[model samples]
Target: MAVPRQSEAQEYIEKQRIMELFDNITAQLVFHRPDNPKTFMIDYVEKLKESRTTQLDFPCLFDESNIESVFGMLDPTKKGFITSEQYKESTQTLGCDNVDPSPAGSDMDMITQDTFRREVKTGLKKASATFEQV
Candidate 1:
Protein backbone atom coordinates (compact mmCIF):
# COMPACT_ATOMS: atom_id res chain seq x y z
CA MET A 1 0.00 0.00 0.00
CA ALA A 2 1.13 3.52 -0.83
CA VAL A 3 0.66 6.61 1.34
CA PRO A 4 -1.88 9.08 0.06
CA ARG A 5 -0.78 12.60 -0.79
CA GLN A 6 -2.15 15.58 1.09
CA SER A 7 -5.20 17.39 -0.26
CA GLU A 8 -4.82 20.80 -1.85
CA ALA A 9 -6.15 22.50 1.28
CA GLN A 10 -3.65 20.68 3.45
CA GLU A 11 -0.85 21.51 1.05
CA TYR A 12 -1.81 25.18 1.13
CA ILE A 13 -1.94 25.23 4.90
CA GLU A 14 1.48 23.65 5.16
CA LYS A 15 2.99 25.85 2.48
CA GLN A 16 1.66 29.05 4.03
CA ARG A 17 2.25 27.94 7.62
CA ILE A 18 -1.38 28.71 8.53
CA MET A 19 -1.41 26.26 11.40
CA GLU A 20 1.70 27.76 12.93
CA LEU A 21 0.17 31.22 12.70
CA PHE A 22 -3.07 30.05 14.29
CA ASP A 23 -1.20 28.21 17.02
CA ASN A 24 0.81 31.33 17.86
CA ILE A 25 -2.35 33.44 17.96
CA THR A 26 -4.08 30.91 20.14
CA ALA A 27 -1.14 30.69 22.51
CA GLN A 28 -1.02 34.49 22.80
CA LEU A 29 -4.74 34.65 23.53
CA VAL A 30 -4.46 32.05 26.28
CA PHE A 31 -1.42 33.71 27.77
CA HIS A 32 -2.73 37.26 27.73
CA ARG A 33 -6.44 36.51 28.38
CA PRO A 34 -7.73 39.87 27.22
CA ASP A 35 -11.33 40.80 28.05
CA ASN A 36 -12.04 41.47 24.38
CA PRO A 37 -10.70 38.51 22.48
CA LYS A 38 -11.90 39.67 19.08
CA THR A 39 -10.22 43.04 19.41
CA PHE A 40 -7.13 41.40 20.79
CA MET A 41 -6.87 39.00 17.85
CA ILE A 42 -7.43 41.83 15.40
CA ASP A 43 -4.64 43.86 16.96
CA TYR A 44 -2.40 40.84 17.20
CA VAL A 45 -2.81 40.00 13.52
CA GLU A 46 -2.32 43.62 12.55
CA LYS A 47 0.93 43.75 14.52
CA LEU A 48 2.06 40.54 12.84
CA LYS A 49 1.34 42.01 9.43
CA GLU A 50 3.20 45.17 10.34
CA SER A 51 6.13 43.14 11.60
CA ARG A 52 6.36 41.33 8.29
CA THR A 53 6.60 44.64 6.49
CA THR A 54 9.13 46.15 8.90
CA GLN A 55 12.65 45.10 9.93
CA LEU A 56 11.98 43.44 13.26
CA ASP A 57 14.90 43.23 15.67
CA PHE A 58 14.61 39.60 16.73
CA PRO A 59 17.43 39.81 19.29
CA CYS A 60 15.62 42.61 21.14
CA LEU A 61 12.82 40.17 21.99
CA PHE A 62 15.13 38.83 24.72
CA ASP A 63 16.48 41.57 26.93
CA GLU A 64 20.23 41.68 27.59
CA SER A 65 19.71 41.80 31.35
CA ASN A 66 17.43 38.81 31.28
CA ILE A 67 19.85 36.82 29.09
CA GLU A 68 22.63 37.64 31.52
CA SER A 69 20.43 36.54 34.40
CA VAL A 70 19.81 33.20 32.72
CA PHE A 71 23.49 32.77 32.07
CA GLY A 72 24.23 33.62 35.69
CA MET A 73 21.69 31.06 36.86
CA LEU A 74 23.30 28.37 34.73
CA ASP A 75 26.75 29.36 35.96
CA PRO A 76 26.05 29.90 39.64
CA THR A 77 29.72 29.90 40.59
CA LYS A 78 30.46 33.05 38.58
CA LYS A 79 32.40 30.89 36.12
CA GLY A 80 33.14 32.65 32.87
CA PHE A 81 31.88 29.68 30.91
CA ILE A 82 29.34 26.86 31.03
CA THR A 83 29.40 23.30 29.75
CA SER A 84 28.13 22.69 26.22
CA GLU A 85 25.08 20.83 27.48
CA GLN A 86 24.15 23.69 29.80
CA TYR A 87 24.63 26.17 26.96
CA LYS A 88 22.36 24.15 24.70
CA GLU A 89 19.67 23.85 27.36
CA SER A 90 19.82 27.55 28.18
CA THR A 91 19.56 28.57 24.51
CA GLN A 92 16.61 26.27 23.98
CA THR A 93 15.00 27.67 27.13
CA LEU A 94 15.51 31.12 25.65
CA GLY A 95 13.63 30.00 22.48
CA CYS A 96 16.68 29.66 20.26
CA ASP A 97 16.30 26.02 19.56
CA ASN A 98 17.91 26.17 16.14
CA VAL A 99 21.26 27.34 17.49
CA ASP A 100 24.26 25.03 17.30
CA PRO A 101 25.29 24.39 20.92
CA SER A 102 28.91 23.47 20.29
CA PRO A 103 31.55 25.87 21.47
CA ALA A 104 33.53 27.71 18.79
CA GLY A 105 37.21 26.96 18.06
CA SER A 106 39.00 24.02 19.70
CA ASP A 107 37.14 24.24 22.99
CA MET A 108 34.57 21.50 22.32
CA ASP A 109 32.85 21.45 25.74
CA MET A 110 32.48 25.01 27.03
CA ILE A 111 30.55 28.12 26.03
CA THR A 112 31.12 31.58 27.44
CA GLN A 113 28.29 34.00 28.18
CA ASP A 114 29.33 36.20 25.28
CA THR A 115 29.36 33.24 22.89
CA PHE A 116 25.96 32.09 24.09
CA ARG A 117 24.49 35.54 23.64
CA ARG A 118 25.92 35.89 20.15
CA GLU A 119 24.72 32.45 19.05
CA VAL A 120 21.25 32.98 20.53
CA LYS A 121 20.87 36.33 18.76
CA THR A 122 22.06 34.85 15.49
CA GLY A 123 19.71 31.93 15.84
CA LEU A 124 16.78 34.24 16.61
CA LYS A 125 17.52 36.36 13.55
CA LYS A 126 17.70 33.27 11.39
CA ALA A 127 14.44 31.92 12.82
CA SER A 128 12.74 35.27 12.24
CA ALA A 129 13.93 35.28 8.66
CA THR A 130 12.62 31.76 8.10
CA PHE A 131 9.22 32.70 9.60
CA GLU A 132 8.97 35.78 7.40
CA GLN A 133 9.79 33.74 4.34
CA VAL A 134 6.93 31.43 5.17
Candidate 2:
Protein backbone atom coordinates (compact mmCIF):
# COMPACT_ATOMS: atom_id res chain seq x y z
CA MET A 1 0.00 0.00 0.00
CA ALA A 2 1.19 3.47 -0.87
CA VAL A 3 1.67 5.80 2.05
CA PRO A 4 0.09 9.23 2.09
CA ARG A 5 2.37 12.18 1.37
CA GLN A 6 3.55 14.16 4.36
CA SER A 7 2.85 17.86 4.77
CA GLU A 8 5.74 20.35 4.97
CA ALA A 9 5.37 20.63 8.73
CA GLN A 10 5.38 16.87 9.04
CA GLU A 11 8.48 16.66 6.88
CA TYR A 12 10.24 19.26 8.99
CA ILE A 13 9.37 17.41 12.18
CA GLU A 14 10.63 14.15 10.70
CA LYS A 15 13.89 15.78 9.67
CA GLN A 16 14.36 17.22 13.14
CA ARG A 17 13.68 13.84 14.69
CA ILE A 18 16.22 12.16 12.41
CA MET A 19 18.80 14.80 13.21
CA GLU A 20 18.28 14.32 16.92
CA LEU A 21 18.68 10.58 16.46
CA PHE A 22 21.93 11.09 14.59
CA ASP A 23 23.15 13.42 17.30
CA ASN A 24 22.38 10.83 19.92
CA ILE A 25 24.11 8.11 17.89
CA THR A 26 27.15 10.31 17.40
CA ALA A 27 27.37 10.96 21.12
CA GLN A 28 27.28 7.22 21.78
CA LEU A 29 30.01 6.47 19.28
CA VAL A 30 32.27 9.30 20.34
CA PHE A 31 31.89 9.08 24.11
CA HIS A 32 31.73 5.31 24.41
CA ARG A 33 34.05 4.25 21.61
CA PRO A 34 33.26 0.58 21.88
CA ASP A 35 36.23 -1.79 22.06
CA ASN A 36 35.25 -3.49 18.83
CA PRO A 37 34.10 -0.86 16.35
CA LYS A 38 33.08 -3.38 13.68
CA THR A 39 31.06 -5.48 16.07
CA PHE A 40 29.48 -2.42 17.64
CA MET A 41 28.50 -1.08 14.22
CA ILE A 42 27.05 -4.42 13.13
CA ASP A 43 25.13 -4.82 16.36
CA TYR A 44 23.92 -1.26 16.37
CA VAL A 45 22.64 -1.55 12.80
CA GLU A 46 21.03 -4.88 13.48
CA LYS A 47 19.36 -3.54 16.59
CA LEU A 48 18.02 -0.56 14.67
CA LYS A 49 16.62 -2.85 12.00
CA GLU A 50 15.02 -5.07 14.61
CA SER A 51 13.48 -2.20 16.54
CA ARG A 52 14.24 1.47 17.11
CA THR A 53 12.78 1.02 20.59
CA THR A 54 15.37 -1.53 21.57
CA GLN A 55 16.70 -0.90 25.11
CA LEU A 56 20.32 -1.61 25.95
CA ASP A 57 22.15 -1.66 29.25
CA PHE A 58 24.97 0.81 29.88
CA PRO A 59 27.71 -0.05 32.35
CA CYS A 60 28.56 3.44 33.50
CA LEU A 61 26.37 6.00 35.17
CA PHE A 62 25.90 9.33 33.44
CA ASP A 63 27.29 11.54 36.19
CA GLU A 64 26.63 15.24 36.56
CA SER A 65 30.28 15.86 37.51
CA ASN A 66 31.42 14.81 34.06
CA ILE A 67 28.94 17.20 32.50
CA GLU A 68 30.07 20.04 34.79
CA SER A 69 33.72 19.47 33.97
CA VAL A 70 33.02 19.67 30.25
CA PHE A 71 30.94 22.80 30.67
CA GLY A 72 33.67 24.39 32.80
CA MET A 73 36.18 23.68 30.08
CA LEU A 74 33.89 25.33 27.54
CA ASP A 75 33.25 28.28 29.83
CA PRO A 76 36.72 29.20 31.04
CA THR A 77 35.64 32.69 32.05
CA LYS A 78 33.17 31.22 34.57
CA LYS A 79 30.43 33.36 33.11
CA GLY A 80 28.00 30.45 33.61
CA PHE A 81 27.69 29.90 29.85
CA ILE A 82 29.50 29.74 26.55
CA THR A 83 28.80 31.48 23.28
CA SER A 84 29.04 29.70 19.93
CA GLU A 85 32.37 31.30 19.21
CA GLN A 86 33.74 30.33 22.60
CA TYR A 87 32.52 26.79 22.15
CA LYS A 88 34.10 26.64 18.72
CA GLU A 89 37.36 28.11 19.92
CA SER A 90 37.60 25.89 22.99
CA THR A 91 36.85 22.72 21.05
CA GLN A 92 39.40 23.72 18.44
CA THR A 93 41.95 24.48 21.16
CA LEU A 94 41.30 21.02 22.60
CA GLY A 95 41.86 19.48 19.13
CA CYS A 96 38.31 18.16 18.86
CA ASP A 97 38.05 17.84 15.10
CA ASN A 98 34.72 16.02 14.91
CA VAL A 99 32.78 18.29 17.24
CA ASP A 100 30.74 21.12 15.78
CA PRO A 101 31.71 24.53 17.14
CA SER A 102 28.22 25.95 16.93
CA PRO A 103 25.83 25.82 19.84
CA ALA A 104 23.74 22.67 19.56
CA GLY A 105 19.95 22.10 19.75
CA SER A 106 17.39 24.90 19.50
CA ASP A 107 19.85 27.42 20.83
CA MET A 108 22.03 28.59 17.95
CA ASP A 109 23.79 31.43 19.74
CA MET A 110 24.78 30.43 23.25
CA ILE A 111 24.65 27.48 25.64
CA THR A 112 23.85 28.15 29.27
CA GLN A 113 25.24 25.79 31.89
CA ASP A 114 21.74 24.51 32.65
CA THR A 115 21.10 23.91 28.97
CA PHE A 116 24.38 22.11 28.59
CA ARG A 117 23.64 19.93 31.58
CA ARG A 118 20.19 19.09 30.30
CA GLU A 119 21.54 18.23 26.86
CA VAL A 120 24.26 16.05 28.33
CA LYS A 121 21.71 14.19 30.43
CA THR A 122 19.46 13.75 27.42
CA GLY A 123 22.33 12.45 25.30
CA LEU A 124 23.33 10.05 28.06
CA LYS A 125 19.76 8.79 28.27
CA LYS A 126 19.73 8.27 24.52
CA ALA A 127 23.04 6.43 24.66
CA SER A 128 21.80 4.23 27.48
CA ALA A 129 18.66 3.36 25.58
CA THR A 130 20.33 2.79 22.21
CA PHE A 131 23.57 1.01 23.10
CA GLU A 132 24.15 -2.46 24.51
CA GLN A 133 26.23 -3.22 27.60
CA VAL A 134 29.63 -4.70 26.77
Candidate 3:
Protein backbone atom coordinates (compact mmCIF):
# COMPACT_ATOMS: atom_id res chain seq x y z
CA MET A 1 0.00 0.00 0.00
CA ALA A 2 1.13 3.54 -0.79
CA VAL A 3 0.45 6.67 1.25
CA PRO A 4 -1.32 9.54 -0.46
CA ARG A 5 0.44 12.90 -0.76
CA GLN A 6 -1.16 16.15 0.29
CA SER A 7 -1.78 18.91 -2.29
CA GLU A 8 0.97 21.52 -2.36
CA ALA A 9 -1.28 24.17 -0.86
CA GLN A 10 -2.35 21.98 2.03
CA GLU A 11 1.16 20.71 2.68
CA TYR A 12 2.66 24.17 2.74
CA ILE A 13 -0.05 26.48 4.08
CA GLU A 14 -1.79 24.15 6.51
CA LYS A 15 1.11 22.05 7.71
CA GLN A 16 3.60 24.91 7.81
CA ARG A 17 1.09 27.43 9.23
CA ILE A 18 1.66 30.09 6.55
CA MET A 19 -1.35 32.09 7.70
CA GLU A 20 0.17 32.35 11.16
CA LEU A 21 3.42 33.49 9.57
CA PHE A 22 1.63 36.32 7.76
CA ASP A 23 -0.37 37.24 10.85
CA ASN A 24 2.74 37.60 12.96
CA ILE A 25 4.41 39.61 10.21
CA THR A 26 1.48 41.99 10.02
CA ALA A 27 1.39 42.37 13.78
CA GLN A 28 5.09 43.24 13.88
CA LEU A 29 4.66 45.75 11.08
CA VAL A 30 1.88 47.50 13.00
CA PHE A 31 3.91 47.49 16.19
CA HIS A 32 7.15 48.80 14.68
CA ARG A 33 5.71 51.25 12.14
CA PRO A 34 8.96 51.19 10.20
CA ASP A 35 9.64 53.75 7.48
CA ASN A 36 10.40 51.00 4.96
CA PRO A 37 8.05 48.12 5.51
CA LYS A 38 9.42 45.92 2.70
CA THR A 39 12.95 45.99 4.07
CA PHE A 40 11.75 45.53 7.60
CA MET A 41 9.68 42.51 6.62
CA ILE A 42 12.63 40.97 4.77
CA ASP A 43 14.89 41.41 7.78
CA TYR A 44 12.22 40.16 10.14
CA VAL A 45 11.62 37.05 8.05
CA GLU A 46 15.34 36.40 7.91
CA LYS A 47 15.56 36.54 11.69
CA LEU A 48 12.58 34.21 11.99
CA LYS A 49 14.27 31.74 9.66
CA GLU A 50 17.45 31.92 11.70
CA SER A 51 15.55 31.37 14.93
CA ARG A 52 13.75 28.36 13.49
CA THR A 53 16.99 26.86 12.21
CA THR A 54 18.41 27.27 15.72
CA GLN A 55 15.32 25.62 17.28
CA LEU A 56 14.27 28.84 19.02
CA ASP A 57 11.07 30.79 18.51
CA PHE A 58 11.83 33.82 20.71
CA PRO A 59 8.53 33.74 22.63
CA CYS A 60 6.44 34.79 19.64
CA LEU A 61 8.41 38.05 19.35
CA PHE A 62 6.58 39.70 22.21
CA ASP A 63 8.73 42.50 23.62
CA GLU A 64 8.39 44.84 26.59
CA SER A 65 6.50 47.35 24.48
CA ASN A 66 4.01 44.71 23.33
CA ILE A 67 3.44 43.64 26.91
CA GLU A 68 2.99 47.24 27.93
CA SER A 69 0.44 47.76 25.16
CA VAL A 70 -1.53 44.71 26.28
CA PHE A 71 -1.50 45.89 29.87
CA GLY A 72 -2.61 49.35 28.83
CA MET A 73 -5.49 47.97 26.81
CA LEU A 74 -6.67 45.96 29.77
CA ASP A 75 -6.18 48.66 32.37
CA PRO A 76 -7.52 51.52 30.18
CA THR A 77 -7.26 54.09 33.02
CA LYS A 78 -3.53 53.79 33.68
CA LYS A 79 -4.47 52.34 37.05
CA GLY A 80 -1.18 50.45 37.13
CA PHE A 81 -3.10 47.21 37.72
CA ILE A 82 -5.87 45.02 36.45
CA THR A 83 -8.21 42.54 38.05
CA SER A 84 -7.16 38.89 38.05
CA GLU A 85 -10.19 38.06 35.92
CA GLN A 86 -9.07 40.47 33.23
CA TYR A 87 -5.59 39.01 33.29
CA LYS A 88 -6.95 35.50 32.89
CA GLU A 89 -9.24 36.43 30.03
CA SER A 90 -6.53 38.34 28.19
CA THR A 91 -3.99 35.56 28.58
CA GLN A 92 -6.47 32.99 27.30
CA THR A 93 -7.33 35.26 24.40
CA LEU A 94 -3.64 35.53 23.56
CA GLY A 95 -3.40 31.71 23.38
CA CYS A 96 -1.45 31.42 26.62
CA ASP A 97 -3.40 28.50 27.93
CA ASN A 98 -0.79 27.27 30.36
CA VAL A 99 -0.16 30.58 32.10
CA ASP A 100 -1.57 31.12 35.54
CA PRO A 101 -3.64 34.26 35.50
CA SER A 102 -2.72 35.31 39.02
CA PRO A 103 0.80 36.58 39.50
CA ALA A 104 2.95 34.79 42.01
CA GLY A 105 3.50 36.27 45.50
CA SER A 106 0.73 38.81 45.06
CA ASP A 107 -2.90 39.31 45.97
CA MET A 108 -4.91 36.95 43.82
CA ASP A 109 -7.52 39.62 43.04
CA MET A 110 -5.25 42.18 41.36
CA ILE A 111 -2.30 42.02 39.00
CA THR A 112 0.13 44.88 38.39
CA GLN A 113 1.76 45.66 35.09
CA ASP A 114 5.17 44.49 36.22
CA THR A 115 3.73 41.27 37.58
CA PHE A 116 1.78 40.66 34.41
CA ARG A 117 4.85 41.21 32.26
CA ARG A 118 6.97 38.93 34.41
CA GLU A 119 4.43 36.16 34.49
CA VAL A 120 3.81 36.40 30.76
CA LYS A 121 7.54 36.29 30.05
CA THR A 122 7.94 33.21 32.20
CA GLY A 123 4.93 31.55 30.65
CA LEU A 124 6.11 32.25 27.12
CA LYS A 125 9.49 30.76 27.92
CA LYS A 126 7.84 27.62 29.24
CA ALA A 127 5.54 27.43 26.26
CA SER A 128 8.47 27.80 23.87
CA ALA A 129 10.33 25.02 25.61
CA THR A 130 7.28 22.79 25.38
CA PHE A 131 6.93 23.50 21.68
CA GLU A 132 10.56 22.63 21.04
CA GLN A 133 10.13 19.32 22.85
CA VAL A 134 7.31 18.45 20.52
Name the candidate that leads on lDDT.
3
- lDDT of candidate 3 over 1-134, digit per residue (tens): 56556686576566565665677778778878999999998987776666666755553656679888999999898888888888888777665666864475347577888888877776654443322233
Model 2 Cα lDDT, one tens digit per residue, 1-134:
66656786677656445554465556557887999876865665566545445444332234779768888877778987777666555444432434433445326566778766665554555444433423
**What TM-score does candidate 3 get on C-alpha atoms?**
0.53
lDDT of 1 at 2: 61
TM-scores of the models, in the given order?
0.69, 0.39, 0.53
- For candidate 1, write residues 18-110 as lDDT tens digits: 775776677668878999999987877776666666746431245567778888998899978888888777777766767875657216676
TM-score of model 2 (CA atoms): 0.39
Which scores better on TM-score, 1 or 3?
1
Name the runs in model 3 displaced over 4 angstroms: 1-8, 33-35, 53-62, 65-82, 92-115, 122-133
The deviation in Å at residue 44 for candidate 2 is 16
RMSD of each: 4.8, 9.3, 5.2
Model 3 has an lDDT value of 0.70
Better of 2 and 3 by lDDT: 3
